[model samples]
Target: MNYQWYPGHMTKARRMMQENIKLIDLIIEVVDARIPLSSRNPDIDELGKNKARMILLNKSDLADERENEKWQEYFTQKGFHVVKMNAKSGAGVKNVLPVIMEACKEKIERDKQRGIKNRPIRAMVVGIPNVGKSTFINAFAGKACAKTGNKPGVTKGKQWIRINKNVELLDTPGILWPKFEDQSVGAKLAMIGSMNDQILNLEELSLELLGYLHKCYEGILAQRYELEESEDRLAMLSAVAKNRNCLKKGNELDYAKASNILLEEFRNGKIGRITLEQA
Candidate 1:
């Protein structure tokens, strides 16, 4: 799966992010827990340089626990405050508040020293689409928060949601473009449902996913779809089709319908909390 991203959109997103960076104290970057490295935008390093940074390994509920720990350590070693979370369910979200304050401790102390007291730490949530930014905000703020509407010169209608006395978050998440030049990166994103479904070959993607599950997870396919363990990837796909009764008008196996079933099941966690990538 290859993505054709226009440079014009990239330029605009970059420009908008640069402008927003100046008005915030911390950058809350959300990345898919399954492919933490691949899901991240490389340009974030440049854009967030000299700013306090925190990495939320969102959707941690669906990722492998061991891989999640490794990814947390990986990003922390690189000077990013890392937290593993299930943004949809708000699991591991409460831990984020303390981490957020810790990430911006220096800035908070600076403000205190200059006699600027009672000011909440300003934060902006940013990530590529479908990484669950809106869900996170909604979960974090609940129903008690107020939207501070329209700051001058900061995009005419941008609203800020006061998370608490100590933290205020920008209501809108900054959109970042993924690095789609790497074919593996694109494939991983597509497997995780971040890419557009119309352009993908479902059968091909399902086969690739099956190959990964057989190699990394082992016996997952056998347990889920009641298939014989085999080294051949296509054989496993065929077995899945056969078990699920995916067939055509002439009683031929319908590989495409089976492929859709496989991918959808994986996405909805019917395949059982499988993560596509590891450390």
Candidate 2:
């Protein structure tokens, strides 16, 4: 399915990022571990040029462990300091600060040489919507310094949070590109709850997800739904609906309900530690 979502606030958010990017010494980019490349907004490379960069693979607990390692290596090869983390439970969060210092060692030494002592390293957290920027900030800061929400666009403005004497964080709203030129990227974002569900066709999306799972993660559906996988994706969804007892008053299968259940389970990691994209 083809997809595109660009809200008005995102335009403003982009402008805000451009205005505020120059104030920070580092850019902390968070990407969903399941779909790291798809979740990344390439504009950040241009927006954050010449700044220290760190890639936090958030929600790593839900992604395939092997894929996480590959993604870490992929980004490291491109010179980004990478950390795999689950911001919700604060797992792997402790490594972030030290990695940030290491990534910006040159800048820190320059400050010392110029005698600019005690300047806190300024970093701005940025990512596409629902990739867990606010959660990361709260976890990293050891407090709820920013508002956290499961829905996209929870962070509407900019707020600087001081994590410690030596580091400060500027939290910005998640910004998606104005257009998704590749439809696969949009689909992956939608699967990860980065897009508004009201505007999507859940049943069709579920079918797409089922097809992907059947191909890449073969026994997931069989294990989760207790039904044999089928070549026809719709047939597999029907089996899931029957197994889950999603039915209407007339005893017709409620495909929509079944679809929602499947999507939610996958997003919550009930299906397993599955990664949608590979390095």
Candidate 3:
């Protein structure tokens, strides 16, 4: 299992991010809670040097609660303000305001020291696409919020959504690329449906998923699909196909159809609330 990310796209995004980063006080980064490390692009640390950072573990409702706690502790230990949230449902959204204030306390105090009053903490929401950035922005900004248009000497056509008196969020989110150096990381990203499916072998990918579930979460197969769990990965997949009646024109069992069904079920949480990785 090998993977390659678009360096050209990343380079362009980095340049744009560098240009936009100077105008902001904090970087609110979002990552999928199921594959926290894999979904993150490490270049953000260098790009956002000396800036206050907050990590929102998005889509936490589908992940293991215990692992989510461990991940929060891990990020906090490294000096990042971490929040577990389900951006789609707006769960845990209320907690972000105080954490934002906490993350940018120094900047807020600096404004007061300089006789600057009522200055909102400017922030940019950043993340890899499909990690719930748009959904979060909608939830965070809500219906009644106003967009502060471009000001004199500011970047042309820049707009900010005033999210209350204490904070104003950038209308656009900074896009980051996924890490594809490690094969395992790539596999994990694929399993979570973050990567493009066109480049993947669905049957092979399904087997890899089965392997992980068999190890991390035993008996999930027997319970969900009514298939016998076996040490042989292909045999388990065949059983799944047989149980689901995934067949082709000649009445032959179609592993590809079964693979698609399995992956889709897992991705949409039809199988269950399962997390692919652990602490």
lDDT for 40 (candidate 1) = 82
Pairs in steric clash, model 1? none
Alpha carbon deviation, residue 29, candidate 2 (Å):
0.2
Candidate 3: Cα lDDT at 105? 92
State how far residue 73 of model 2 sits from its true place (Å).
Answer: 0.4
Candidate 1 stretches with Cα past 4 Å from truth are 4-11, 144-158, 171-179
Clashing pairs in 3: none
Global Cα RMSD, each model: 4.6, 0.7, 5.3
lDDT per residue for candidate 2 within 65-158, as digits (tens), equals 9999999999999999999999999999999999999988999999999999999999999999999999999999999999999999999999
**lDDT digits (tens) for residues 10-35 of candidate 3:** 45656767888999999888888988
Query: Which sections of candidate 2 miss by over 4 Å?
Result: none
| Candidate 2 vs 3: which has more TM-score | 2
Q: Is candidate 2 or candidate 3 better by lDDT?
A: 2
For lDDT, candidate 1 versus 2, the one ahead is: 2
Q: TM-score per candidate, in order?
A: 0.89, 0.99, 0.89
